[model samples]
Target: MLKKYSATPYVIWSILFIVIPLILIVTYSLSTKNPINGQLVFSFSNYRKFLELKFINVLLKSVTLAFKATIICIILGYPMAMILSKMEAKLQKKLIVLFILPMWMNFLMRTYAWMVILGKNGFINKLLSMVGLNLNLLYTRGAVLLGMVYNFLPFMVLPIFTVLLKIDNNYIEAAEDLGADKLTVFRKIIFPLSMPGLISGITMVFMPAVSTFVISNLLGGGKEVLIGNLIEQQFLVLNNWNFGSALSVILMIFILVFMAFINKFDKDNDDKGGVGLW
Candidate 1:
């Protein structure tokens, strides 16, 4: 009976930190300042402003870059995860630490370091110039995408690795005994089972990639504006909390909808794998 009260603190914390802050954001997003009386009045003006062409372009660019980064992470991370999951238990632990080492560093510092490496006079360009070749590398959309991939790769890898590890070897063995080839087994069994992890990794990487301002601000040299940068400008530079909150609310909605779509996809994939593989 006493143990039932243990959740009370968590409930209180959620209400205070999560629920209250969300309530405040929603309130601000739906209200605009009245110039005559200097008070907030209910309005859809902020959301309407978001539908403008400039903001729409920013949102599309942010989504496109995020999608590119997420796809790259999947291509790179899935193989790393597969390799890690197949290793000996002792070696797997060591490798996971290695994979996670960079993540321990400050996120801001990691992005700043990228700026140094990608700058015109930085590492890559310097090496290229020595060979009588020079290329513009920094402050481009490619730089932002690279930054996103580097920072968020581990988030994609770890989840998928965990899922692959949890998959029973018996499933693979059964599939092999039933005359299934490696590709067939993977298609019908391994990949389907790993969908949960893949989706989780997507959620982890995409959420941050889509909304990150630091990577774009630093690697993009402020010329490329993402939804996050827009929101930051509204709140910090323009002193327009209402518009910032509105953008945030929309971002939240996008995330929620994406998660719903991923969940449905995962569920549908679950039904696709039957006893034929076994």
Candidate 2:
């Protein structure tokens, strides 16, 4: 009885914060402001408006950029995790801490730091100028992608490292004893076992990349705008609460659907024993 009641505070907190806010967003999304008397009326016009081509293009660009970042993170992070997993346990802990230390700082600050590094007169450009080569490094899609990767790479690496550490060395040894090469053993055993972590990393990296306004705003410089920027403009700048709520609802749905798809795909791959070494 005491344990059950102990959860009451948490339940109340969730209701007050999470549930109520979600309810308000939904209500606002399905309503419209009256043109004549300034009253809110129940309507689907907000959602309907999102079907326009401009909004659809914004959504597509957001997804494409996020996907690119997630892919890059996986490619870079997997090797780093593998290397870390092979290190001495003591050294691994220190290196992991070092990797995570940057994350302890405010993310906004981190993004701003990148602005200094990537700006036209920034460190990279100055270094290149000394070598008699000048490059435009800032306020571009590549710069935004770099920021996303830098911020989220740790999310990818940590999960994969954890999974790799948990894997039994016996599996690899057994494969070797059966005359399998290192590549074969990894393909058959290590890679398959690490799928759960990889999936988690993808989710961690992709979701933030998809919804990020700050990195785009700072690195992309007004030239690049994402769905998140659009939503922010609708709410704070345009004062179209109903439309903003509708966009928020759409973004939430996209995230949910993507997560569901990833979950299903992970399960399917697991059932099939992942990629076959043969």
Candidate 2 backbone collisions, by pair? none
Stretches off by above 4 angstroms in model 2 are: 269-278
Kindly list the per-residue Cα lDDT of model 2 for residues 1-278, writing each as its tens digit: 99999999999999999999999999999999998999999999998899964698999999999999999999999999999999998998999999999999999999999999988889998999998987888889999999999999999999898888888888888999999998999898899888888998999999999999988999999789999899889898999999999999999999999999999868987786543211
Best model number under lDDT: 2
In order, what is each prediction's RMSD in angstroms? 2.8, 3.1
Model 1 per-residue lDDT at 63: 91
lDDT tens readout by residue for model 1, 72-102: 9999999899999999999989988887898
Q: Which residue pairs clash within candidate 1?
A: none
What local lDDT score does residue 173 receive in model 2, on the 0 to 100 scale?
89
